[model samples]
Target: MKAMRFTPPGYGGRRRDPDEVKRDGWRKQGLLAVSLDDQRLTWPERELVRQLGERLYGARLDKTEDKR
Candidate 1:
């Protein structure tokens, strides 16, 4: 597993990289990545990742509502 940096929301007043966010979303769907540090993640964010991983392995994600 690659050790990707997990940037917390609103860190240092710096905006997150959109590309990085997209990459992380892809990685979560594959379940091939893990957070480098849990302490930096909020509870809901962690849960969202967990659910995404489960959905990725268990069922097809619904794309009907996703405009991207």
Candidate 2:
């Protein structure tokens, strides 16, 4: 197994191999994980996700918010 090492005091965040900056500095922001249940989502959008999930897999047996 690999061992974990502490980052140096002045370490910067992750960088791309080419490191070419995109418009509005998206490259510097790196990757981010957005959740479907985020409060920013509208009601219609959440409904769409629920419907799509049901069609792709099957109807959710329970009525909880954990649709996915």
Candidate 3:
């Protein structure tokens, strides 16, 4: 019997030579890359995306604001 060790997300036992995160996802899971507007994301995931977007870009547009 072997005990499983839990590692943090980025520091886990992943390949070092080449990053397998996106490649494996594209190959195995048939899932594309990250999308902030993906409907499959949960509320927390959406919030994280929103925060990251605002952090990188400017603040999000208000819903009440009209786009010309």
Candidate 4:
């Protein structure tokens, strides 16, 4: 499986590769393990993520404050 990348919404930064993030969820808590290739999100879920990203990480808002 290729490296996993996670760029959580509302976080001001570039996408974070899986290697960069810790897998504490499995080490600390016995939560279900998610494989890089096994992780799949539904279309709706994906759309929601896109929308949230646009709202949060969208281009600087104040830059276009004037409606001229």
The candidate maximizing TM-score is 3
lDDT-superior candidate, 1 or 2: 1
Q: Candidate 4 has which clashing residue pairs, if any?
A: none
Is candidate 1 or 3 superior in TM-score?
Answer: 3
Task: Evaluate all candidate structures by whole-model CA lDDT and list the values in order.
Answer: 0.66, 0.61, 0.73, 0.57
Overall local distance difference test of candidate 1: 0.66
Off by over 4 Å in 1: 1-32, 59-68
TM-score ranking from best to worst? 3, 2, 4, 1
What is the C-alpha lDDT profile of model 2 across 1-68, one tens digit per residue? Answer: 87658777547677644324432255456643333486777988878777777797687667756654
> Candidate 1's residue-wise lDDT over 1-68, tens digit each?
88758767676566668657767878787524545246668888887877886877664347675543
What does candidate 3's lDDT look like per residue over 1-68, in tens digits?
A: 87657776767565554335666878998965556766889989988877877897779678899865
**Each model's number of backbone clashes?**
0, 0, 0, 0
TM-score of 4: 0.34
Candidate 1 deviates by what RMSD?
16.5
The runs of at least 3 residues in candidate 2 whose Cα sits more than 4 Å from the true structure, single-residue gaps closed, are: 1-36, 63-68
Q: Which candidate is the best by lDDT?
A: 3
Model 2 scores a C-alpha lDDT of 0.61
Q: Any residue pairs clashing in model 1, and if so which?
A: none
Quote the positional error of residue 67 for candidate 3 in Å. 2.3
lDDT of 4 by residue, 1-68 (tens): 97648856857678666643546555676544333233376767666665665786674336559743
